[model samples]
Target: MGKITGFLDYPRLGETSEAPAQRRKHWREFIRHLGDADASTQAARCMDCGIPFCHNGCPVNNLIPDFNELVHQQDWRRALEVLHSTNNFPEFTGRICPAPCESACTLNINSEAVGIKSIEHKIIDKGWEEGWVTAQPAARPSGKSVAVVGSGPAGLAAAQQLARAGHAVTVFEKSDRIGGLLRYGIPDFKLDKMLIDRRVEQLRGEGVQFRTGVFVGDAGAGSAYDKVETIAPEQLKQDFDAVVIAGGAETPRDLPVPGRELNGVHFAMDFLPQQNKVVAGDRLDRQILATAKNVVVIGGGDTGSDCVGTSNRHGAASVTQFELLPQPPLQENKPLVWPYWPIRLRTSSSHEEGCQRDWAVATKCFNDDGAGNVCSLTAVRLEWKDGRMAEIAGSEFEVPAGLVLLAMGFVSPLQHVLDAFGVEKDARGNARAGTDDYRTSVDRVFAAGDMRRGQSLVVWAIREGRQCARAVDEYLMGGSLLPR
Candidate 1:
């Protein structure tokens, strides 16, 4: 520990964010990173716990205490090195990750946890400012080729690792751009796209090839982008020695209520990508705008919060979020759930942006006003008894909802790609591949990220990508020097 008594001296200090009203005017990052001195002070709060549960808490197994000590000692360069050692894109996780590591911090047992994510955010930002992040090409070529199918965090991490390990790596994206979900699904206000662009440039300099607008399976009507080029699964298997299925789980769950086919109802993925395209200056034939409309976002997760934020940015007449489950406690029972992710109410920056929220309410149907477009939503309040929910009597109500965004989360990877490659699937419909090997049933085929494990956080995606890259490298070269 850099400072033995620092934990007692310092309180947790989170990053400051712009007021919701001011930030909703434009699409850009609103959270301000902690200054060097404040970050060091925060890092110094990392106590010398006998066991660092934050190591296990972090999906990529980040060396939390080591980096904290480095930052506290004011060794910015070493801190960056420690950060990049495990995770390929700390910039992404630093901004979007929920910081489970902080929940698992030892000090959190009785006091505020160390501000790990905020410190990480500052470290990476400083690393970029000092030009410490750059290209690292392999000294020699291994003459092996790997095809990573997807350009999300997982695919990018796997591609970067494989390329640095002396393997030729080409990442194919179904969308017109390189980043899959990171560039599209997420709203720009949370993460600036320039950060992704900077990493893309670095990867290009390191001999990684990015093939955008190329779908690796049947360009089916469901989730494939417009004007995408189709490449058969067999084509990739034939061209490359190994194929890694890093394509994310894009199959969204549907709400099959009456009038779901109405004009104003859309999946979150469909609605989110268009805003991102517009932010990037692309002209859309038709844009889904929430401006001056009564917007209703369904779901209680981060995706739902993003919709609320985006709607607020669009100057919607009103924004309302509905969560099917009952609200959680304001404070977690830390003694019962210490060193683990606790069940507690989490209020994101978006939730603070003037959106009305209701819990334990289920949408009954979308109401139409003579026209084909949706006008309002009918819902009912529910009460839970023995883990079963029952509608409360006389609690039915209707709210104006000219626009409805379904943020219910993704169910599985698009089945077309899995079917095209003939990869076996688990009960959950994700590709059947064990974490130890990450090899699919098909020979020379591997899976990782949301494709293997179901829809998950960006941190888990990076962890899977790194481990899958190691497995693929070992399979190709009989051994791998890359970390798991």
Candidate 2:
């Protein structure tokens, strides 16, 4: 609440980006941060609504109104303090989160909402610039230990909160690097990996131990797997005060049609991680080059966008993305969908690079050339009737594709890891853990993140991790000062 009339006086102005042509040339963050004047004007748009629905919209329950007022007053330091009181990594949420709180803003009912995400980004960025972000490492150790499996936003948030709550926290990551999806699945241009590295450094300085390339169980552990440490659920139950499972939902969706096994077909995960490793200096005997090859991406989510970006970086001949459902309206019916994510045709930055996007399309089959490589792809158009897709007759077509990347998302966490730990699973196949308590069936063993919530946003994962940390602390020592 800056000025009583600020909502009417100010219009929303968020961050801008460099020209798409220039940004696509290299893997680097391209967002142009809003200036103090711009940010303050945007913050002024947060109206004096008695009931701030933005709180419910934000998974971390950030005190958004107070921060808006402070930002309007140009009080960056206090704003960050209030922001950090609930969220462990405001800097992270600011950068990658989809900002549901903005949709729920009072002004969004009729006018453009306050640029909440932009203000959040500016607040945390200014805090770090002013060196206000530092390690508090708890006043004293509680002599408790927590093993958090996964180094994504959720795992990192949980580990940081538990460590700050005076518990010894160790985070385990199966990949060679940290930041599960954030590190490898996402392209560097959207979120420069350096941000993650800097946060990891802060967590390290705060006494959180991170062991990368360490498997929690046999799910991802191949025969030649070397464990930095073995973690049996039984042992974790006995040795540590509590164990929190925050591993990702890594089981990728696959296509089962004919010729799928051909050389050119691959999953989005299979293609994405390899490019990430190559960027990190890992040598590839034969690069998975998309250069001058006609490429097709299946699924129209963020992962597909990443495939598009990486393919452009690889200098592809052309890129096409297919989605099964009908195309959404360019603009959402905001009056009906206000305070909730709306159905709209969301175009990503990758699409700006270049992509032929088609919705209401279903992949019929993959046809292979005699040499056992994908040659032609067939698709059929669909019509939505009674809330389901009905294929349109004679609307079939084929495209010449040298490569196809499946980005259809994941179904569940790997079965073996859940099986090995003997944790009960929900109907949806995620580890069964309640948000109210975050406890799995196994005593003192909690679960969080994608491993528990199914495929979700990075911000939700961070919220679960923080809440799980508070739950573990409560279980270990009668109650917790940690924020839930």
Candidate 3:
């Protein structure tokens, strides 16, 4: 520990964000990391307890206390090494992870937990600035080739690891640009695309080949390799020694209520991706516009928060987010929920910008204003009996709405791809590959991330990717050295 009583002396110092009014102006990262001295002080808050539950809390099993101690000692380079040893993309996680590690900190049981996430942000940012981060290309080629489908966190992490292990790795992305959801799904205000671009550059330097704008199933088109060839499922199995499927959970959960086909109504994923593309300077010829329109975003998760932020950026006249469940308490019970992410109201930075949030409300119908366009939303107050919801009497209300975005979460990976691979799907509609096996029904083809584990956090995706790479390596070499 930096100092025995430092936890008591220096209170937890967290990252600061640009004022909402200022940050809403542009699609840029708003959070700022703490400086050296302040960050060190914050790091000192770690008690460095004997049993660090943080290891369990972090999906990647990041060595938190050691790094916190390193940060506290002002050895940021060491902190970065510790941070990167387990997590391939510390910068990404440091920025967006919910920091369950902090929640499980021993200090959190009695006091504010160590500023693990903020410290991680500072460490990686410092490493990048100091030129400590560099590509570690493989020494000799293993002569084995691997094809990784999808360019999301899982695919990227697996490709990087496999490339470093001397295997030729080529990542295939259907999108025009790589980085998948990171490049298009998430808003720039949360994670800037430039960061992803830099990481891509590093991966390219490590001899990882990225093939974009080529759909895997639709393989007759001219590809970067100048091969207008289609590889059948069996063809891929024969051509490549190993295949990894990391496609996202793209199947959106639909609302099957009446009037669901209204003109102004759209899925949250549909709306968010378009906005991200437009912000990236790709002018969508017929993009949906929230400007001068009232927007109602259904679903109370991060996607809804993203919708709220995007609508504010688009200069919408009004914005509202709806949740079917009842509102949670402002604060979670520490004694009951300690070390585990608890149920509590979390107002994201986007929600803070501008948006009306409602809970315990269910949408009933969407009506058109006789112009073949959505002009209003019909909803009803919900009453919970036991665990079911019932519409409360006299609480039916119609809210004016121009654009209605469905921000509900995804249900599963696209069945087309899964069916093409002949992979078994679990009850939740995800690939039936457990963390232990990491392999699908077919041999040599591995699955990870949302494709295997269902929709989850980027951090979990990274963890699954890394572990899956190790499993693949073990299957190839009988014994492997890659970290799990």
Candidate 4:
């Protein structure tokens, strides 16, 4: 440990951010990473705990204490190396991932956990600024080929690893550009798209080929990529030695209620991607805008919070969010759930930007105006008993809403893509494959990330991708030196 009693001496320091009122005027990242001195101080707060529960909390199993010590010792280069050893893109996780590792910190039982995520953000940013983050191309070619479907975090991670293992990797994306969801699903204010472009360039330098606007499935698959060129699954099997399906779960859960067909009612995916595309300099003829409209976002997860943030930037008249479940406690029972993620109320930057949030409420139906646009919605308060919800008697109310966005999260990957590959599906409609080999029922095909595990965090997707890459390398070469 760099400082034995640093945890007792220093309080946790968080990243500074622009005020909500000021930041709401533009679609750009408002949060600033910690300075070097502040980061070192924060890193010094890592207690020399015998067992680092943060390893169990972090999906990618990052070397938390090691990196923290390196940072505290002012060894920036070594800290970056330790970080990149496990996480392919710390920038993404640093910006978007909910720090479960902090929750599991031993010090968090009574005091604030170490600022692990902020330190990571500082390390990666410094690495990029110093030009230390560069391509690590393989020493020699292995004379093998792999085809990766989708260009999200999972697929990109898998492709980078396989490429570094001396294999030819080609990533296929249905969208016109790389980064499936990271380029479209997420808003620019949270994560700058330039980070994705930088990583793509590094992957290219490593001999990884990226084929955008190409769908590796049947032409009439359920995806909305109408103009993409479709490649048959047989063609990939015949051309490439192995295939990795790391596409994200794109099938959004729907709210099947009255007036679902209204003009202003939309799924969060439908509304979010348009704004992202616009931010990327793509002009759309019909963009979904929350400008001057009373926006109602249904769902209580990250996606819903994103909607609230975007609406605020759009100058929305009013923003309201609804959660079907009861509100969690303001603070968790630390004694009962220490060293593990706990259920507690979380207020995101989007929530702080200004949103009226309600819990234990369920939308009964979307109300329609004279035209086909949604004007309001009817909802009822709920009472929970025995883990079941029942509507309260005569507690129905109407809320004015010109725009309704359903951000209830995704259920599974598009079934048509799985059908095209002839891969079996689990009860949850995720691709049926075990993590041991990441091998699908279909020979020479493997599944990873959200395609196999359903909806999860970005860190989990990176972990699955790295593991799947090792599995594919072993399957092709009969053995692999890549990390599991």
lDDT of candidate model 3 versus the reference: 0.87
**Cα-based lDDT at residue 367, candidate 1:** 95
lDDT of 1 at 372: 95
In order of listing, the candidates' clash counts read 0, 0, 0, 0
The lDDT values for all models are 0.94, 0.87, 0.87, 0.95
| TM-score to true structure, per model | 0.99, 0.96, 0.96, 0.99
Q: Which digits, one per residue and each the tens of the lDDT, describe model 1 over residues 450-471?
A: 9999899999999999999999
Q: Write the per-residue lDDT of candidate 2 for residues 1-484, one digit (tens) a residue.
A: 5588988877777689988788778888888678888888888888899999899999889999999999999999999999998887777778778899988887888888888888999998898889998877788889989888889988999999999889988888878898888887877777777788888989998899988877777644453245455566676667778889898888889889888899999999888878877877789776677899999999999899989999998899999999987899998888899889878898888999899999989998898888999987999999988988899999999988999999998999877788878989999899998898899988788999998999998889988988888888888899988878
Give the Cα error of residue 135 in candidate 1, in Å.
Answer: 0.7
lDDT of 4 by residue, 1-484 (tens): 9799999999998999999999999999999999989999999999999999998899999999999999999899999999999999999999999999999999999999999999999999999999999999999999999999999999999999999999999999999889988988889999999999999999999999999989887757354775678899999999999999999999999989888889999999999999999988998999999999999999999999999999999999999999999999999999999988999999999999999999999999998898888999999999987879999999999999999999999999988889999999999999999999999999999999999999988889999999999999999999999997
- Candidate 2, pairs of clashing residues: none
CA lDDT of 110 in candidate 4?
94
RMSD of each: 1.0, 1.7, 2.6, 0.9
Between prediction 2 and prediction 4, the one with superior lDDT is: 4
TM-score of 1: 0.99
Question: Looking at model 3, which ten-residue stretch has the lowest summed lDDT?
Answer: 220-229
lDDT of 1: 0.94
